[model samples]
Target: MENRLLQILVCPVCKGTLRHDREHQELICPADRLAFPVRDGVPVMLPGEARTLEQAPEQ
Candidate 1:
């Protein structure tokens, strides 16, 4: 999973590159301000399954 993620994963919405946030267990799309969840080692890439950054707690 980690191998595939780092090597080739892109945002479904914007087609932009994603950065894995291990602490959050998510793949964040900065341009789209969305976070795709990594569930049981598989990434849930659907937009509807994403969490919006606007609703996220500030770091």
Candidate 2:
């Protein structure tokens, strides 16, 4: 993902800053517990299209 674009993109639902998960190609909204998918370098920011985050174990 481009740093410039990521810097300006926020969660559609919560209007919160997003954290990019480059490896998984996702933009995560921790406040909303959602993961927005990035496909072919384009972010899918639609709420209906987002996947709910499954809790990850603490490291």
Among these predictions, the greatest TM-score belongs to 2
Worst 10 residues of 2 by lDDT: 50-59
For model 1, which pairs clash?
none
TM-score per candidate: 0.84, 0.88
lDDT, candidate 1, 1-59, per-residue tens: 56665668899999999988888788889999999988898999999999998787335
Could you give candidate 2's per-residue lDDT for residues 1-59 as a string of tens digits? 89999999999999999999877788999999998889899999999988888855222
Candidate topping lDDT: 2
lDDT of 1: 0.86
The C-alpha stretches of model 2 lying farther than 4 A from their native spots are: 55-59
